[model samples]
Target chain A: MCELLGMSANVPTDICFSLTGLVQRGGKTGPHKDGWGIGFYEGKGLRIFHDPEPGIESKIAAFVRKLPIKSEIVISHIRKANRGKVELKNTHPFVREFWGSYWTFAHNGQFKKIKTEPLGDFRPVGTTDSEYAFCWLLGKLKKKFKESPQPESKLFETLEILMTELHQKGVSNILLSDSKHLYTFCSTKLSWITRKSPFGKATLLDADLSIDFRKVTTPGDRVTVIATNPLTSNEEWNLYKPGQFQVWKKGQIVFSNE
Target chain B: MCELLGMSANVPTDICFSLTGLVQRGGKTGPHKDGWGIGFYEGKGLRIFHDPEPGIESKIAAFVRKLPIKSEIVISHIRKANRGKVELKNTHPFVREFWGSYWTFAHNGQFKKIKTEPLGDFRPVGTTDSEYAFCWLLGKLKKKFKESPQPESKLFETLEILMTELHQKGVSNILLSDSKHLYTFCSTKLSWITRKSPFGKATLLDADLSIDFRKVTTPGDRVTVIATNPLTSNEEWNLYKPGQFQVWKKGQIVFSNE
Candidate 1:
């Protein structure tokens, strides 16, 4: 029903190349044209741009595309509204602050009756089932751990259990980040690719553009990008299995429920 | 010290003219050049743009100045960075969600030893005293009222008491909003002007730009602009006294401690 694009990197990086490909799907290459939003995490601070306009047609999106605002974590979404009306409030990705860190979430699929779930301290400002689900998940997390859980693996395990419940509701492909890591849960479609020292030229599947990663990146730079669909035609994107959950840190997959 | 600019209007209005003047203070006209941020409220949705660069030189700031994004409520800040480092996380115009509404805050003055205060559910993502004060204030409010206070006046009264506590800590000139209303607390410098029917031309004090409000607005339109200093040279702005608080709705002063 929508598209999600996310990036996690060992160093501050820009998603302009990948974003250019994905935004094409927002209107020109695909039908998801209701609205779009993106969040870029710079250190502990997160800057988000939200527009209730077709990503391909938005001036803000154009500015974002042209300007390379570097960040270690980024999440973006292009919407085809189903549960919520096409409005600025309903646009993804949504954000909430937790444990003194900003957590950003974007959904790519639908959920049945997700709004009926109870929320804790976190509340949804928008009417989307996606936002309601995020609020429910984060509220539950906050209730479980008064602060960020020690032994980070425990947090991952709890997220797996909570996300599985959401998977049972319906298609629940999600991209979420908490400044330090990118967490992904897939119920249906999801794919990711990691580019490192041996980076080569890659052509976009949706747009008439190509980038030679070798020219722009250093040998030590590692960058991982996740999306609902593969953005590059030549890159070897790892497709996620249904009901899988993965956690990425510093451009590498540190945990996965394969 | 920093600069604050806020607007409350009966209808959706763009702050391009005022922003053009205020941004000059971010570097060219004044010394507040550490960072800048602005939040524009569209219904229940909020769109924010943040730049760590001086507002006068920031490309993002330039784009924002040119874009006519209409909003009914707006909160903006240009920082001089006293309590925190000149980083994205330390930039002002902090936000938190309470009772399903997004509360945006922008401060113009420093709060000495404010971060020493205890907090509840809300936490500060950045090490700025201003953000810490916001978290403490909101956490206290959330603790007092599990939901938004039933009687709106009670919330206003409670805010006055809480803000008075902040005033005790140090200078705490703040412009805050919760979608429906703009709540301002002044410990030092703050000023406001309401433009209604029979509007006239207004010229910027910091810049050479001038706007004829009569040509752009209808008689039914009412807009209130709040700033750390009066943005226009020709208009009469009412200055706030120390320890003064005011609540604005539909561009009119609904509550005030004159």
Candidate 2:
């Protein structure tokens, strides 16, 4: 199994404090230390870095920690090879291009020997079932729609049907983003937190670091975080029900079908 | 290390299809499956599940695959032992409570020998660096603000300074949420995708799946996905620059300091 982390906010915010604690699990504080990766969104563009070494020891990881790049959205992961080899090619949080835009995805579970037709346009670069499923999803979307995008409600309906079909195949806990909004679905375990005005104190469980939300945030700011686990010891982290899915935009819950 | 997956949208959406592909990596397609977990937000509450086995083989994972749970925000993860032994206690995606709200986190990196003060309100049940970091972050927020949350810009600035300090110690890529908005920071790698009107075909890079945006989404629907890597084969995946951070809210980029 692996860990997951994500963020959404009403204003541009930095996740350095929380991220510092999370990274320790890559090789130092946790056992995930197979490989590590991260993604940040700056406007419509995304910046990414990945390494096959434990994040605790990787020089690239060190560089990232020292930098303070900022964006409106971000995603990241560390690898613990299971079916695929522990090479750079098999890292999590795969990226692709669609409709002249970039799409990013990361997974935290596995699928057994499931086979599906390959779309001519989408294919897997690695030999992971996770990648295979991504291609299949793209294929379905392309086959169903051709040119214009559908409305949010219609799209949600279509996705609901497709998600149901895919869930039948195997374990599926996923996070997806296009630099604007975020979407997620859980088959097993997941959790989340939201930070807004009247911010309170938050304490890390991995490190001794602590921050006062009142000192950092204003009444106008709102932030939501989703992860495979809770990052803070003092905050209330909500758990996802089995077989649930959601979509988040800004700092509020814009859509859900759980 | 660990893997992370998340989704945000302008409206509620199901992650069934994408999750199916992602879970395969937890122990089937990849090697993260030391344990699996996921979280979904429905209204103000959250649904969560966890398994101490490969998500592909776990009954819980299977149930999630077939279930139609949905929300506007979601988070998920699979574990790869890096710190503590493989057990239910060492799963990714930790959760907690603060200010009458749930806070969740997941991480994908490692920190070196980092030491901090113990949080007064938060403590770790597991011995993972990821958890420690969560506690430290929350503690700092509490100390800085005491009770009232600051503005988003102020929070972001404070985070920037704190992240820079942590980067000095080791690698850190993280995601934090409060069920409303998300905050992400990358010390190493990260990527994202946004789907909206003028949608097109998307091919998965890992699996043989494709989806046509025209059939599933509306012109009014906008979604963003962030990950350590790209998930599609036919879509352009943007990479995060080193030391970058961002905030996601309302299906748009509200603030970025990249």
Candidate 3:
């Protein structure tokens, strides 16, 4: 098994608080210690950091935990290496450019023989079933919408159908983004929380740390955090039922199949 | 204009010493201060860091400069924003995956109105002439070589033709890599140096830093560094002539059109 963390914000925000807790599970609190990767979007430019080392001991991971790289959409993963070997090429939160937009995806579950399907233009550089699925997802989208752009609702509709089909294969708990929206699908375990005005203190579940959101955030700020498991003990997290798909934007769920 | 720095080595090697000097040109030593980026390939896995801020003052740049991350191939750039706005999307050292390998590219010079060419599957996430040229190059390759992997000689020959076409459009000093080979084409300024058994001391041109290769490297290691302009004043560097293309492997020029 693996883990995933995602954030969407109305304004540029940092994931340091949530990241601190997640890194603990990468080795200390959990067994997902093979490697880790994270992606943050600053406008259309996406910055990705991949370390094929345990996040608990990686120097770059520590550097990222302290650096205040702000982004409107963020996705992260810690791997346990169920389907692929523990290597940099197999690190999660893979990114590819499609339709003039940078899309990022990370998976938290395993599947077999997912590569049995024919591929389009996108190909996986690694041997992970997760990456193969991502390539399939993006390749299908690129082929369907080859021209300019498509309406968000139409795209979401297409994605829902695809996700439903993919969920039938195996566990498909995934977090994906197309630079404009954060799309999450629940096949097994997933939870999410949104923070806005009147934010209070929240304590981490995995680490010995806590943050006073009222001191760090403005009233206008709205942020949504989605993860495989709840990272905080105090905050109320909404659990997603199996086969549910949600599209989030500006820190809130804009569309959902609950 | 902008600046480029690349490395190819038989053994995994850290580029911190060379990157330290190149980042200085981002703002402290030169005028190419719009943004900066670098990609390091650990096997087929690539780790890329991009900053829209000037490298001189970027905390992430500072972090990357000190890290001991090693790679067999590396590509980096410092931008001056000739044809695009100063944004993260427009940063240099753009990457795309093809043929089950991550290909990275960076350009030193630029021209406007290059998007007049019809694009294939690959599209530019940023509105930079450099990225547009890269997409065209890769899209052509993906279309022509849609089967399995082609022979390296055939691929290089195709690249040489594409380089000639792109060079005709503008000043196309570029450093590109397909994880297996480092490809460079010089329309104007580019230089390279190969370090072998007889290690020597070298000094940076932009920073007050020096290193003795004897202390850090083994006798069997071979490394080649390529840059838009010579990075070290103390080393003997070979300058590439205009319209020359070189394919480098394991720190040596395996093929070239001198």
User: What would the DockQ be for model 2?
Assistant: 0.01
| Model 1 misplaced stretches (Cα beyond 4 Å) | none
Window of ten residues with lowest summed lDDT in model 2 chain A: A94-103
For model 1, what is the alpha-carbon lDDT of residue B75?
96
> Residue B257 in candidate 2 has what lDDT?
74
Model 1 per-residue lDDT tens digits across residues A99-212: 999999999889988887888878999899999999999989988999888899999999999999999998999999999999999999999999998889999999999999
lDDT of 3 at B2: 91
DockQ score of the complex predicted as candidate 3? 0.90
Q: What shift in Å separates residue A59 of candidate 2 from its native position after superposition?
A: 2.0
Q: Model 1 reaches what TM-score against the true structure?
A: 0.99
Query: What value does the lDDT take at residue A222 in candidate 2?
Result: 86
lDDT for model 2 comes to 0.70
- How many angstroms is the interface RMSD of candidate 3? 0.7
Per-residue lDDT tens digits for candidate 1, residues B61-146, read 99999999999999999999888899998887898888998899888777778767788889999988899989999999989998
Candidate 1 second chain TM: 0.99
**Which candidate would rank higher by lDDT, 1 or 3?**
1
User: What TM-score does each of the candidates earn?
Assistant: 0.99, 0.50, 0.98
